[model samples]
Each structure stands twice: as C-alpha cells, then as structure tokens.
Target: MRIFALPLVVLASFVASAAAEYSCAGPDARTQPPTGAIVVDPTGAYSGSFHNLSEAVSNVPNTTDEHTIFLFPGVYREQVLISRLNGPLVLQGYTCNTKLYAANEVTISHAKAQRDISPEITSGRNDLTSTLRLKTNDVKVYNLNVANTAGRFLENGQAVATIIEGNNYGFYACNFTSHQDTVYANKGRELFA
Candidate 1:
C-alpha cells in the first residue's frame, strides 16, 4: 500500500478556512437587544404582538430594518425558518441567567426527518426539515435551546436540530441538542461563541 501525503499548502488552507467559522467571546459580548424589542410571550405577560413564533417572524418586514424577536419562557413545538428578511435579525431567549446556555428557558423543538417524510413534502430540501432553519444572512441567536427529539437509533434518520445556511450568523449561549445533526452549520461562515 502506498501512502499519499497531502500537500502542506492544501492542509494549511483547509485549517484556515475551518478556523474562520468559529469565534470566542465572553457572555457579555453576546447580542443584547433592548427590552422593547418585539416580544413573543406565550403567556400574554409581555403583551407580545403574536403568540406564535412563526406569526411574529412573518409580521416583520423583509426590508433593511433591524429586527429582534424576544422569546419568553415557553416550549414552542413548531418548525421555524427565517428566509426572507433583508435586514439583520436577532432571536433572543428569555433567561434568568444569560451568561450560560443552561439557563435558557425558550425551546423550539420538532421531530421530523427525510426518512419519515417524502422528498416532495419537504420541498426537496432536507435541510429545511430541521426544527429551526435560517437561510438569511446577518442573523443572531442568543440563549435559546433548539432540539430534535427524534432519536438516531430509531428507524427514522437524519433529524436535525437547527440548520444555519447563511453568512454572518452568530449563536451565543445557545444549546442545540439532538441525536444527529444537532447543529448543521455546513453552508456558511458561522460563529458559535
């Protein structure tokens, strides 16, 4: 058997490109929007504009306006995708302790995979089958938990917690839990700080 040695230049380029996808930052450096930002309180405590996350996202104009979605303490069992916002967007979770991902109180969860659903049903995009999918650039998610309960050992395959396919995306103090493809950040330059 002959050993094929990879070129040093190619190895260095791969390492550099991979390093560009990550960053290190303190919890204080996380994006902290104002309290007056658009709130999504399921208990009707904060007088939110919409009770559902999808509705709140849909209400935002797809223009160059900076928008933020503050999710109060709730277990949102829905599939959310942010695809057509032409501006910077922020999704922040309500947490008693913002310094750590463990204190996150908002959970956006779902259970679906390509093995269980037909390709046509998923619009031929298996990436969209995630619980949370972001297809727009300049997006930030902070202090939230995104989960896919579908077990990898089960017959269903390829369950994804969240899919980040956009550029300039940052996830700070966020917990993404799943058996497989917990956080699919395969497409763009992402920062999981």
Candidate 2:
C-alpha cells in the first residue's frame, strides 16, 4: 500500500508541472488595450505605430479572451502569421478594399522547397497562397482583401492569401483574392463563410 501511494504522488507532481507549462494568457490579463476600439495605423497614437499587419498582430494579447485589431487604410506588404495561442482574435480593416500584400511569391514549386507547400495549386497564375496565415481558433476577420502580387508581372509564382489552421474561425465581408492558393483552411471545424 505504501509503495502504491508513493507512485501516485509522483504522478500527481508530474501532472502539475505539465499543466504549469500550458499558459493561456487568460481573459483577465490582457496586456494590450481591450478589443472594443483597438486600431493600427501609421499616423495613429497607439502602443506601436504599425507599418504592416505583422506588427499589429505582434502587439495583440495571446489569450482566450476576445479582442479586435483594427487596421487603417494602407497597403501592408509582408507575410502575416497568426499563432494558435491567440484564440478569439479579430482582425478588421477600415474599408472593404483595404489590402494586405505578400512579398514572397507563393508557388507550389517554391512552397515545396520550404516544406510549407499548400495543397491547392492552380495554373502558374492562380496558386492559392495568400499573404496572411491564421492559426488560431474562433478568429474573425472582416472587410479586407489579402493578395499576392508577386506573380502579377512574372506570371510564374503564386500567392497564399489566408491560411486558417484552427477551429471555429469566421470571415465576414472579407475578400481573399490571390493568383495562387487564395485561402488555406486546414483541419478547422465549423468555419463560417
């Protein structure tokens, strides 16, 4: 009986240590401004004047709490990756046509090289890669167009617009238009159009 009890105690200690490593930046501990009216703009006064979408996401709080990151009108030229830890995040553009452009040409040929190749590929013209990669659950995006302008002149490479890798994500009034992999929704459950 004593030996069995000792093993149980050791198992409990291990479980506690593992749980501590899983830190979710809970709803109550938001480091950024609340989601109600957070905005990102080059001319605005905020924690950081983000010149691109990636900078905006970097400032967002990673937690289960719901928060919104509003982007102003501008052409954001960069690859944006939204992490899985930031669930219930929202990225909204001020206008319907606000655009996020990708610098890298997304191509099955090129993507394969990186081992991050997208599943869908089109005629060297319409590869489905967009400029944005979303990996969080329950995220919402609205009124923005994600595009890859790399192959526009060369007509070889493609662009991946948006990659959704989490569950319960939603996109409303958002336009994902790219020459290649437009939107990559991977293993996500209950994604709203």
Cα lDDT tens digits, model 1, 1-193, are: 1233557667888898766533233444333337557778777766545686888888877679888888878899999987857899989887756677976778998888767676566453457568998888898888899998877736777788988878998898999987776788867789887
The alpha-carbon deviation from the true structure for residue 190 of candidate 1, after best TM-score superposition, in angstroms, is 0.4
Which segments of candidate 2 are over 4 A away from where they belong? 1-36, 45-48, 96-129, 152-157, 190-193
Check candidate 1 and list the clashing pairs.
none
Question: TM-score per candidate, in order?
Answer: 0.77, 0.58
Best by TM-score: 1
Q: After superposition, how far is residue 62 of candidate 1 from its true place, in Å?
A: 2.5
lDDT of 2 by residue, 12-86 (tens): 999988776433234322233344645666556566556566776777776667778776665666667777665
State residue 85's C-alpha deviation in candidate 1, in Å.
1.1
